[model samples]
Target chain A: MQHKQTVIDIRNLSYSYVNEETSNRVSVLHDVSFSVSECEFVSIVGPSGCGKSTILKLIAKLLDNNHRNIGIDRSKMSFVFQDFALFPWLNVRENIGFGLKMKSLDKKSLDIVVNEKILEVGLSGSEHKYPHELSGGMKQRVGIARALAMSPSILLMDEPFSSLDMLTAEKLRIDLLNIWTKYKMTVVMVTHLIDEAVEMSDRVIVFGPRPTIVKKVCEISLPRPRDKRSKEYFDLCDLISKEIL
Target chain B: MSRIILGFHLTKKRKHIFTTSFVLISIAVIFSYIIIISGDNAGQLINSLMLSLFRLVSAYAISLVVATIVAIFISNSRFGDMMIPIFDLLQNIPSFALIPLFIYWFGYTNIMTIIFAATSILWPILFYVLHSLKTVRRELDDAAKIFGAVGIKRVLYFLMPVAFPSLVTGSIVGFSIGWEAIIGVEIIGLASGIGQFLNTPVGNNNNQILGISALLIIVFLINRLIWMPLLRKSQLYAA
Candidate 1:
C-alpha cells in the first residue's frame, strides 16, 4: 500500500480556558497529538466534555493556537458546525455559497458551484427556503453543502449530525460517507458515538476524559459497504467504546 | 389556473391602493379645512412643524450612525467592560438637565437643539446593538471566521446583519425619545418649532388645539409609514 502524505500534523498541543471571575486556568487538552493523512476520514471519540470538539477547534484555529505546533493550510479548511449555523437571514442557496462569496467569486461561477452543491446534498427544490424553515436533517444537509462549496482540502465537522434524530442521522451519515468517497477530501470529525466512529471513519482516535489525551488510534480495516450486523463491526465498536468507558 | 391566481392578486392589490388613496384624500381635506379655519396662524404652524421635523430627523440620523460605530467599536473588548458602565451612568443623567449647558454653548440655536436630542436618542440604540453583538452564538461567530469573514468583511457580512433586528428596535425606541427631546428643547429655549408654537401665547383655544392636532398627526403618520414597515421587515433578521 502506498503511504499517504500527512495533511494535518499536531504535536504536543495544549489548551486551557481562563475563568473570568476567578482568573483561573481550566485545562482542556494536555499534550494531545494526532496527525491525519491525505484523504483519510478520522473521527475523534470521547466522553462528554472530554475536549474532543476542542481538538477540532484547535485544528481549525477557531480558538487561539498560542504558538502550538499545529500544521495545516488554514484557507483550505471548512467547518460544519453542530448547530447548523446557516445565516438565518439567507436562504439555502446563499448559505451554501457563503464561503465562495467571501472569496469574492464572480456571480456566474458562484451560482454554478452553489447549484452543484445543492444537488449533491439532495437539497434540490428547497433553494429558497431559510434555515428556520428546514428540518434538522435538511439543515445539516445545508451545513454540509456549505462546507463542500468551498471545495476544501480538509473538512472539519464538529458533531454535524448529533442534533438530528437517529433515522435522520443514519441517512445523513451514509450520505456524508458517500460525499467523502466522491470528493476524496480529508475529513476529521468529532463525534461521541462509537458505532458511528466505527461505521464511517478510516481510523478512530479515541480520547480520554479531560484533560484529554489520545488513548488509542484504531484502524477500521472493514471493507467497503460495511454491515453493522456483522461481528467484526460490533467488535470494532466495542473495542473503541471500551476506551471511553 | 395561473391566470386566475394572477387576477386574484391584481384585485387584492387594487383594493389596497383604493383604500390607501381614500384615506390620504380624507386627511388632505381635513387638513385644508383646518388651515382655512385657522387663517394666518396656519402658515406659522406649518413652518414651525417643518423646522421641528427637520431637527428631529437630523438628530436621529446622527444618533444612528454614532451608535452603530460606538457599539461595534467597544463590543467584545475589555474596553467594553469598562466603558459600558460609564455609558450606563451617562445615559441615566437626566437628558433635560444637559439642555442648560447646550443652551449656554450654542445659545438656543438649531445645532444645540439637534445635539440635545441626539443625546437622548443615542443610548438606547448603542446599548441594544452592543447587547446583540456580545450575545451572538459562539458557533455562528466561528463559522463566520472560518469562512473568511474577517476584518471589514466580518463587520459588513456577519456583525451588521446579526445586529440588524436589534438595530431596528433600538431605532424605534430612539426615535420616540428623540421626538420628546427635540420638542422639550424647543419649548425650553428655541425661538421656532412646533414646541415653541404650542408654547407661544395664542389668541384663542382653537389655534392651540390645531397645533396639538397637527403634531399628533405627524407623529402618527411617521410611526405608521416608516417605523412600522421597518419593524415588520426586521423580523426576517431574527435567528
Candidate 2:
C-alpha cells in the first residue's frame, strides 16, 4: 500500500473527566492510539460511553489534552455536532456565517462564502429561517453548512445523521458522500451504526468499552455507489459490528 | 437589498403600535403634570415624581452593569467559588437593611437614595445570570470552542445570547424592586421624590391625585415599552 500523508496522529492519548461534586476522576479514553490519512473518510464506531465522540473532540482541539502525543497536522478544522448545535437565535444564513465572522472575514466575502455553502448544503431557501423552524434533516444540513463555510481541511462530525429518521439519514449520508467527493476534505465521524461506518468510510476505527481502547481497524474496499445489499458489504458490516460488540 | 438582508421577524406591527401608544400616553401625562407644576398649579408633585424615577433609573443602570460583570466573573473564574457563597449569604439580608448604613455615610441625600435602590435591584439580576450560566447547554459551548470563540467574543456571541432570556427576566424583577425601593428610601430619608408627594397631599392641593396618577402611568409605560418587548424578543430567540 502507498504511504498516505498522516493528517492526524494519536499515541498514548488518555482522558479523564473530573466530578465537580465528588472531586473524583473517571478515565474515559486510555492509551488510545490511531492515525488518519490525509483526505480520508474515516468513522469511529463503538458502543455508547466508549469515548468515540471524545476522540473527535480531541482531534478538533475542543477538549483539554494533557496527553502529550496527540497531533493534528491540519491547519483548519471544523465540527458538525451530533445535536445539530445550530444557534436557535440566529437564522440559517447567520449560523453558517458565524465561523467566518469569528475569523474576521469582511462582510462582502463572508456573505459570498455563506451563500455558497448554504446552496451546497441545499439550504438556500431556508437562509432566513431559524433552527427552531427547521426539520431534523434541515438542521443537520445547516450544521454541515456551518462547518463547511469555514473551508476547513478537516471536518469532524459527531453522529451527524443519528438524530434523523432512516430515510432522512440515508439521504443525508448519500449527500454527504457526494459533497465529500467534490470537496476532498478529511472527515472523521463518530457513529454507533455499523452499517453507516461500513458504507461511508474508507476506514473504520472500532473502540471498546470505557476506558476505551482501539479494538479494531477495518478498511472497506467497496467501490463507489456502494450496494449495501451486496454479500461483501453485508460481510463487512458483520465484521465491523462484531468488532464493536 | 439591505432591508431583505436585515429582515428580522419581529413582533407584529399592531402590537408595537399599541405599546408605543401606551408609552406615549404616559409621557404626555407626565409632561402635562410637569407643565402644571412649573406654572405653580400642581406645586412640587411633578418634580417629586420625576426625582424618584430619575434616582431609580440611574441606580437600576448601575446595578445592571455591576451584576452582569460580577455574574460573568463568578461563572468564569475561581473567584466564583468564593463570591457565590458570599452572595448566597448577602441575598439573605434584606436590601432595605442597607438604608441605615447609606444614610449614615451619605446623609439622606440623592446618593443614599440611589445606592439603596441599586442594592435592592442587584441580587435578582446577579442570581438569574448565574443560574443561566449554570444551565447553558454543553453542545453550544463545544460548538463555540470549535469555532475559536474565546474571551469577549465568547461572551458577546455565546454567553450573552444564552443568558439573555433569564437576564431580561431578572432586569424586569430588578426594575420592580427599584421602583418600590426608591420610593421607600425617599420616604424614610424625607427626601424630595414621589414618596414625599405621597406623604404631603394637602386638602384641595390636587397634588395627591396627580402624584398617584403619574406613578401608575410610569409603571405601566415601563412594562409596556421596555419589559414586554424584551420578554417577547427573549421568547422568540429562545425558540
Candidate 3:
C-alpha cells in the first residue's frame, strides 16, 4: 500500500489547565504525540475527563503553546463544536458566511457561497431563522456548514454530535461521512463514544485519563458502510473501550 | 415576523408596518416643528438646551469609543489583568472631584462641560465592556482565531457584537449619570444651559417651576425617542 502524506505531527506535547481561583495547575495532556494523514478520518476516544477534547484544541492551536511542540502543514483549520456555537443573533445564512465575511469577501461572492453551503447542509428553507428558532439537529447542521464554508484542509470537531439524540446522532454521522467523502478533507474528531469512533474513523486514537497519554491507536479495517452489529465492528469497539477502561 | 408598536409586540404584519411608519413620521414632525418655530424667549432657552444636549451626545460617543478600545486592550493583556483592581479603585473616585481640575484646564467652557460629562460616562461603559470581553466564550474566540479574524476585523466582527448587550446597558446608566453631571457643571460654572433656565424666571414672574416641567418633558422625550429604540434594536444582537 502507498503511504499517505502526513498532514499533522505532534511531538512531546504537554499541557495543564490553570485554575484561576486557586492558581493550581492540573495537567491535562502529558507528553502526548500523534500524527494524522491527509484525508483521513481520525477520532480521539477515551473515558470522560481523559483530555480527549484538549487534544483537539491543542491540534487546532486554540490553547497557548508554551508547553508543547505541535506542527501542522495546513495554515487554516475549522471547528464544529459540541454546543453548535451558532451566533444567536445571526440567521442561518449569516452564520454560514461568518468566516467568509471575516476574510472580507465581496457581498456577491459571500451570498453565493453562503447560499451554496446552506443548501449543501440541508438548511435551505431555514435561511432566515435564528439559532434560537432551530432544533438541535438543525443547529448542528448550520455549525457544520459554517465550518465547511471556510474550506479548510483540516476539520477539527470536539464532541460534534454528543448533544444530539441517539437517532439524530446516527443520522448526522452518516450525513457527515457523505459530506467528508465529497469534500475530501482531513477530519480529527474527539469523541467519548467508542462505537462512534469505530464506526466513522479510519483510525481511532485512544486516550488515558488525565494527565492524558496515548493509550492505543486502533485501525478500523472494516469496509465502508460499516455495520454496527457485525462481529468485526463490535470487536473493534470492545478493543478501544478496554483500552480506556 | 412580529414588530414593536407602541412598546408592544404586534403580530399582524400589515398593521405593524403601518404603525411603525406612523410612529416614525409623527416623531419627525414633532422634532422638526420644535426646531423651526420658537419665539425669541423660547428660542434662546431652546438653543441653550439643544447645546447642552449636543455636548452630552458628543461626549457619550467619545466615551463609547474610548471605553471599548481600552476594554479590549486590557481584557487581552496580562498586564491588564493586574491593572483591573487599580481600575476599580480609580472608578470609585467621584467624577465631580475631577471637575475642579477640568475647570482650571478648560476654564468653564463647553469643552469643560463635555469633558466632565464624558468622565462621568466613561467608567460604567468601560467596566461593562471589560466584563463582557472577559466573559466571551472560549469556543467563539477560538473560532474567530482559526478563521483568521484579527486586528480591527476581530474587534468589529467578534468582540463588539458579543459585547453589544453590555455596551447598551452601560450606555443607559452612563447617559443618566451624564445628564446629572452636565446639569451640575452648568449650574456651578455659571455656563448657560437648560439648568440655567431652572434657576431664573423665563418670560414672566415665577416661571422657574415651568422651566423644571419643561426639563422633565425633554428628558422623557429623549428617553422615549432615542434610548428606548436603541435598546429595542440592540435586543437583536444581545445573547
Deviation from truth (RMSD, Å), model 3: 3.6
In the predicted model 3, the residue pairs found to clash are: none
Q: Ten-residue segment with the worst summed lDDT in candidate 3 chain A?
A: A66-75
| lDDT, residue A103, model 2 | 81
Scored against the native two-chain complex, candidate 1 gets a DockQ of 0.84
Better of 2 and 3 by lDDT: 2
Candidate 2 C-alpha lDDT tens digits along A1-245: 88789888899999998978999998999999999888899999999999998888777777887635778854588899999888889999999999888888999999999989988989878989989999999999999999999898889899999999999999999999999999899999999899998899999998999999999999888998899999999999988888777
After the best TM-score superposition of candidate 1, give how far the Cα of residue B175 lies from its true spot, in angstroms: 0.8
Per-residue alpha-carbon lDDT of candidate 2 for residues B37-119, written as tens digits (9 for 90 to 100): 64674547667777888999999999999998888888988677778888989888987788888888999789889988998
The regions of model 2 sitting more than 4 angstroms off are A20-24, B1-43, B201-208
Model 2 chain A: ten consecutive residues of lowest lDDT: A66-75
Candidate 2 CAPRI-style tier: medium
Task: List the candidates ranked by TM-score, beginning with the highest.
Answer: 1, 2, 3
Tell me the lDDT of model 2 at B178.
Answer: 91
**What lDDT score goes with residue A129 in model 3?**
93
Docking class of 3: medium
Q: Give each model's whole-structure lDDT.
A: 0.90, 0.86, 0.84
Question: Clashes per prediction?
Answer: 0, 0, 0
Between prediction 2 and prediction 3, the one with superior TM-score is: 2
